[model samples]
Every structure is written in C-alpha cells, then in structure tokens.
Target: MEECCRLGLAKSIGVSNYSCAKLSTLLQNATILPAVNRVELNVAWQQQKLIEFCKDKGIHVCAFSPLGAYGFHWGTNAVMDSPILKDIATAKDKTVAQVALRWVREQGAFPIVRSLNKERMRQNLQIFDWELTDEEVRRIRQIPQQRACTWKEVVSPDGQYKSLEELWDGEI
Candidate 1:
C-alpha cells in the first residue's frame, strides 16, 4: 500500500476493522498514514476511544453497519429497534434509520449504509438535514455497548487472534 501510494497508483490507503492498538503499530511503521479506517460502528457499538485516536491522527473513521446491519444475516434489530432511537425518531418525525444515520454523522464519521432499495437509499441521505439533541445523544451514550458482528469464522485458536478480545485488541 505504501508503494502504491508512492507510485501514485492509489491516492490513499485505508484499513478495515483495525483497532487503535493495531493502528498505533501501523502508524509507527507506515511511511504513508492510512486515509481512513473502516469499522463496524453504530449507536450501540460505539467505539469512542478508537474514534478519538483516529481523530487525533487525522484518519477518517468510516462507519460500517451504521444502521446496525439490521435485517441482514450478521445483523440484529438492536439498533433499529432501540427504544431510545425509536423515541427520538418519533419526536423528530423521522424514521429510526434516519436517526441512527444522523447520529453516526454527528459523531464526525462517514456512514456507509448498504441498501438496494431506491427509496431507502434516498431516505438514508436525509440524515444530514437534521441533528440529534444533546439529551438524545446522552441517552444513546448510555445504551449498552456490544459488538454485533462476532466474526466467529475468522477468529480461531490456530489463527492470529484466539478470541474476540485479541481480535479487537481488547477494544471489544
């Protein structure tokens, strides 16, 4: 990736699912710092420390599963079905998805929403028009944080990461 960046083949390099610990090591050795770090982020699984570290390093935090990946194989209804988010959406006259996306944006991260439906895609873009209240954000901050994607198939006893804690560098 450094070679690609130096050669001008790729304008910038980005990493995915990298913890702050891994990024610290990468920053030490990398000639070219990563432009972005993509990770699973949502109201429930907010990696606040990681976000701050990346912010300090000037690395953009791109949120994957910003809506909690709801209605998908590895997704759960925890985000969309959250009582707090639902209440906020109700008060704002917006959908739960919009509230969630807005929250992701409000955190100074770019949300990567996956949707094939045209209307849904259009609705996802509506987040930028509004903002979450401080109280709403506080309520969201109190929601129990847990990683939704376990990635059971990737982490193994024989693999580099023996457990979730190791895989997430204890950020989980």
Candidate 2:
C-alpha cells in the first residue's frame, strides 16, 4: 500500500477481494482512503451493505461480471436463472443481459462488463441509453444473496477466515 502511494503510479489504490477487516487495517495504516474497491457484484450477488459501507467511506465500489457469465457452467446458478430478470427483460423488450447491466448502473456503481461478440458488446453499452424504473431496481436488489466466486480452496486452512462470511465480517 505504501509503495502505491510512493510511486504515484495509481492516483488512488484499493483492493479487490479484500475482507472488511483487511480494509479496516489498510485504512488504519494509510493516509488516504481507496478510490475504488472492485468486487464480483451483480443482480443475483448484490453486495448491497458492503457497497453502502464503501460509499460511506468515499470509496467507489466497482462491479465486475455485470452480466452473469453464462460461459462458465460451474459458476452458473439458480439466481442467474431468475425469472424476475427475464420478466424485466421482456417488459423492456431488451435482452436479459441488458437488463442485468442496467440494474448495476442504476445502483450507482461502475459495472465492468465484457463480451467478445459484437452484438453483445453493443447491447451492453446500450444500458446508458436506457434506464430501469426505481421499482425495477428495488426488485432486482431483492434477489437472494449468493456468491458466484469463492476463494475457499485458495485460503490456507490455518487462515483466520474459514469462509467468506468470516472474511466479510459475517455480513454473509
């Protein structure tokens, strides 16, 4: 963290996949708050409270995988299979991917979405041209909270956090 501040390479440095406790430590040791904290955020796995906490600290929350990556079958789950998102898509006459992307943008966080397909690339960018209703956004936020990616196998068994919940201060 000090190296980032010293080199001046990053205007502001933050962490991705850092637990709340780790963030607290960083904050305690640092002179400047992080400008952004990127995380796996989406309609199904909306980290609402965490996002709010970051916003309260003036740390911008950036969402990755805005469009449920259907490419990864292991990562796909029922939350991504929600009919609610499909309903919104039907009502808006837009693709489910578009509705998902729009929902993230409406939440006041920058969503990092990528697609190799030309049509999908165009569709994702079209979110800015349209908007979801406040009610729609609320409904999207109601999605059952779940994590699509986890580092359970990666963390050492002797580590303090046995699960992501412990890592996130039991927010899970």
Candidate 3:
C-alpha cells in the first residue's frame, strides 16, 4: 500500500493501532513511509510517546475516539467526564467534546469524531475556528493518563500477542 501510494496508484497509505516497535520495524524495510497512523487518542488515554514517534517519522497521527468513546462496550467516558476538561470548556464557552478535540488538534493530530445529530455534528466541526490557550494545554497535559481502549481479547497465550504488554509494546 505504501509503495502503491508513492507510485500514485493511491492517494495515501496509513496504519491503525500500530505501536512504536511495529512502526520501527516497518520503517526499517519500507520503501515509502506511511502517511498516517489512526489510533484511539483522547485526554484520558493520550498516546504521547506514539504521537512523538509518529511526528518524528513524518507520519500524521489521526485520532480516533478523541472524546474517549463514551457509551461503547469497550470504552469509558473518562475524557468527557473529566473535571479539568469541563472547567476548560466552561471557561472557553465550548462543549467538552469540542475542548477535547481542540487539544488533539493543537498536538498536530487530526481528530476523527462522530455525531449522529445534525446540531451535534455542527458543534464538533467548530473546533477549527478557535484554539486552546497555552495554560489550558498545560492543564490538560496534567490530567491523569490511562489507556481506555486496550484490546485485551486479542492478547492470549496462544495468540500472536502473547500478552497485553506485547500487544502495545509496553505502551500501556
């Protein structure tokens, strides 16, 4: 896919949920670097190390579940429920979701969010117009970090990822 993208057969190429180790291995042999990496990233589950690694590699990080995937079976509403985010949103006169998305955008990652309601979708799109302040960004960085979307079922003694640690390359 990377080669095809480079050859103009495709517009772009990317990977999803890839760890630093996997990306390094791909980089070792790839003829063309990946254009993007889509992953679960949010205030509560910020993939800081992965973001930095991708940035250094010239790979754009596309954030999935930037608001923490609330209400999903495998997700929690940690980012949405965060008091610090709430405060920031209130101070900025924006929604919590908007605040969260803005933070990801400030980190140079593209946020991929979903909202079924027309008004809600419009609200999500408003993130581009405004920006989060440096102090707000600093406060957001202080929020407790936790991986909310760990795919534990994929890791087993008989599976390719023998342990959860191996699945994330100790990133969890």
Give me the candidate number with maximum lDDT: 1
User: Where does model 3 exceed 4 Å of error?
Assistant: 6-8
TM-score of each: 0.97, 0.87, 0.94
Query: Top model by TM-score, which number?
Result: 1
Give the alpha carbon lDDT tens digit for every residue of 53-86 in model 1: 9999999999999989888899878899899999
Q: Which runs in model 1 stand beyond 4 Å of their true positions?
A: none
Worst 10 residues of 1 by lDDT: 124-133
Cα lDDT, model 2, residue 98: 82
After superposing candidate 2 on the true structure, give the runs of residues whose Cα lies further than 4 Å from its correct spot. Answer: none
The lDDT, on a scale of 0 to 1, for candidate 3 is: 0.90
lDDT tens readout by residue for model 2, 1-172: 6577779876768679655666778889888788888888888788877777787788887887776565575355544477889888899998888888778777788888777789889887888888898888878878777677675665565887666666666755
- Candidate 3 residue-wise lDDT, 24-46, digit = tens: 99999988888999999889878
Worst 10 residues of 3 by lDDT: 1-10
Residue 147 in candidate 2, Cα distance off native in Å: 0.8
